[model samples]
Target: MVRGNIRGSAARGGIAACCGLAFLLFGYDQGVLGAVIGLDSFRKEFDDPNRNLEGIIAAIYDIGCFVGAIVAFLTADYFGRKGSITLGTWIMVVGTILQTASFEKIQMIISRIITGIGNGMNTAMLVIQSALIAFGHPLSTFMGLASRQAEPSSFGWRWPIAFQGVFIAAILMFLPFLPESPRWLVHKGRIEEATDVFARLAGKNSTINDPDVVRERDDIVASVEEEKKLGEATWSEVFTEGKNRNISRVLLGAGPYMMNQWSGINCLAYFLPITFERNIHLSVELSLILAGVLGIQYFALSWL
Candidate 1:
């Protein structure tokens, strides 16, 4: 039994790691614009001199995020968490390609919107995935480790976006091995499949091959059945009845967290090269190397 528990924990940890990859993509997308916009080519391409256009381009991405969040909330219940995440991955791929190919500021703005949508959807999916994993297994430790290692280097923004594409592909490949949330399955009235998933996750070869697995499955079924008999509202109905009020409150309260991005620290760090070259009278290459060192310091602080 102890061995089985260990195996089960490991499997869940693997799934959480997969979900964390998605989150890392989200973070990379969030930070890539800052890093790349500081490059001479990017500024010259956009014909931006005083850095005014940078804020507009960045804000467009945030606008896209607003749209994506609304869409994710509406579709998560209908499509299921895994399905939504898969869709988000496709969006990320297309957005990355568009951004990479963009030659004009307007085109890049559109691409940022596309990428922002993907990021927002993936963020919602990450929360759902975390909750699902936490339901059946202890995932705090895995999540902590994953969060610490999410960011990569600051060479160029393209590297991070390209890395996102690679990780998204890896996630899609690994999704087939993961069990869908049994709670979601049960809610959808897929009792037998839910039981099988639970058994598999618990390391049983088959649902019928293990007595403890059978008992656990029965418990879940019975609990879901009881809830069904109580005529609990559908997601939409619950939302209408203020069931989501607390969630809304929490989200609203956390809005200030996004302000951290605009706190000037990241902007200064990103443009450290330009700042040094223009303000302190340094060479571009030397300024870039200094900027990199400062970026490393910020990245290290993220882990702390």
Candidate 2:
């Protein structure tokens, strides 16, 4: 039976709050790198590797992320969205800790990979990020500045990286209380649970057969039925299924994102301060300030 409170505002609020926070941490991790890569103390410690090396250092995260995305799809059938997200959070916490504690290049790279894996898993379940996740950019920038100012030491980069776990902890705290995705439950043939979750999320305090709840639940169940009619879902079917040309649709959908990732946009986000300071010959202080501004812009526009 659905928990009496499951359909209350509290449950929906909990879902949004936890998911938003996790996404926020993911964004902040992405943004903080730009600042971390350029810090004077960090550069001095690591001898300011060349652009290619720096690129490799940053890009390896994507490698792990790619692997994680595949793993997410493969495992999601069994684990469900909530399970995947929970496991991802644990991996991210471990990754964030290792990243914070790193003292060497390879260690940082490995940690980045671990962190990316967690992100990839989380994203697979829920890719919607806007206002909340956007905070990651500005906060990362702010943390960078704070770290710099606190300094006679290297705490600037480390602290921002480390604090990522704070958000992760919040997510984990709420996970147990949250309902699994209704769609996932439906797909797994847990119709009653799906109906309950749908009603709860919609803030409707209604019975299993209540008109509104039944309509929504039936709509979702119909989709699952359609999939069942199409033969067991498999990689082979993805390329051959549906009048919409499923493979083409998938390509159409993912093409832009694929292009964007390959574009140098993220490279700039991760290493903007370094790029400005090194290539443009801007003063380090000035470059960092500009990077912070860029973060602010990203944050504001993310809501759009």
Candidate 3:
């Protein structure tokens, strides 16, 4: 291809699109609850849930996510990126089903843990999680509100929760075709497979032996070799080092997410409509509508 020629394929763009959608799903699931939790039917179904109950329902997912991350870290080498995500996706589907079908708060809490474990596997940069919350929260709120319009029904909140199914379905469809992360391929010593995947990502007419492809693949292998030389790592390294204390880097890496959770931003993301209604004294309908507007803003801001 020419230096500036149009060069992208379904494989190339599809992977990006799938990643975007996956993150979107993550945000949607996280945010959807604020709206659902605020509904009259939901409150009744769960025995008039209070702020404390809301907090529990909202926070339990994080617990599950933490556990999931540990599992992912331990088993990542064996599962590969694609396999890990696929497994997480399946777990999420089960969690979604439970969350959607749940009538009691206990059931919902359990579901949250299961779903969170799945999400934990996929979590990365705090910004990405924030972006997901921003986009999905309001949409979910409105969906719950819409379902409630069919008054005298006890199942309204379930519809909004059920919407997670749609996102999961999309992921299942695209995930299999999405190329594996190059590092995982290289880690497993599948150099040729990694090369082909890299070539495909690069574009048409690119071959496994293409200089750019080969160089990039070698860089990954070299990086892995350097890591091997460093030998097995221990959690202790995160706190100690010879002269270069890794604790500082660890704290720096963790600070954003810690701030996000402790600063009340995440709580707000999952309970915005509730906050608007209960604290700001807005009517339920108006609160959700405004929350939807906030979601739109969050989605727009994510591109930056």
Candidate 4:
């Protein structure tokens, strides 16, 4: 870890900023293609792929994301939170580069999958900052407009895709300087380091043995120990109930997300501009513009 002097709320704020940037990047990537996919230039370049192909192009990223999440689930404990995040950021950088340079439909599909994997590894979003993803929609619509050149230039679409790198860059620049997840540290049996992190989080003058820090550290360690007593869960055990109600708890947590996919917000998020043009019979310019306006409203309202 790149140790720094920041402590208390300042340190916490820095951590929050990094996470916010990541979510913003995630939102931007999700929304950027929504408008771009509807662009005349993009359509022309890709030979106006049928809706079925477009769906695959749009949805394949989530497949990569699923793979990434599973990978993180299996490996995060071994890598630690910071390590996983750092590794994922680098993977995203590669993915973004490939995406921005894509010249073929296949290339774009592969690059997006790679990018999704990276985002999945880092996990998802924070509540209020989750709006950054929505905010990305408008920003992407604006950037997609860069393709309005009289002569067909790919710069508009490429630039927006490339812009994802800026968020990733911001994350990489600051992440190394911040502390790792203290819980992960404790899980790895590094109590002293975890204690130091808790102390640092507590305040500038706090020490590993500070009463409040010790109490917090001990509490976490105790929690970790208690969890270990449950033993490692096998797949069969996970699906069946013994003492943990594992399957029920899993369903409760996953049900909302499953319903969300069913709710068709993703339909709006991924295809709003296209839907407006094709379904509502709006002009292309008006569709893109309205999509952006709606994105702004989504961002604003998410705070509630």
Whose lDDT is greatest here?
Answer: 4
What C-alpha lDDT does candidate 4 achieve relative to the native structure?
Answer: 0.83
Off by over 4 Å in 2: 1-6, 131-133, 237-244
168-278: candidate 4 lDDT, tens digit per residue: 999998887788888988888989989989988898889988899999999999999998998776899878866888899888999998999889888888888889989
lDDT of 3: 0.79
Q: Where is model 4 more than 4 Å wrong at Cα?
A: 124-128, 146-151
Task: List model 2 lDDT by residue over 1-304, tens digit each.
Answer: 2334656688878888877887787778887877777776676656776777788878888787787888898899799889998898899988898888888888888999999999888876775555665678668877787788755477867887887888898888888889988888999999988987877776655677778889999999999889889867678767884786998888888999889878878867677777888899997678878887877787788776
How accurate locally, in lDDT, is each candidate?
0.62, 0.80, 0.79, 0.83
Residue 41: error of model 1 in Å?
2.2
Candidate structures ordered by lDDT, highest first:
4, 2, 3, 1
By TM-score rank, best first, the candidates go 4, 3, 2, 1
Better of 1 and 4 by lDDT: 4
lDDT of 1: 0.62
At residue 103, candidate 4 shows an lDDT of 81
Residue 107 in model 1: shift from native, Å? 0.9
- Runs with alpha carbons beyond 4 Å of true place in candidate 3: 1-7, 124-132
Query: How far off is model 3, as Cα RMSD?
Result: 3.9
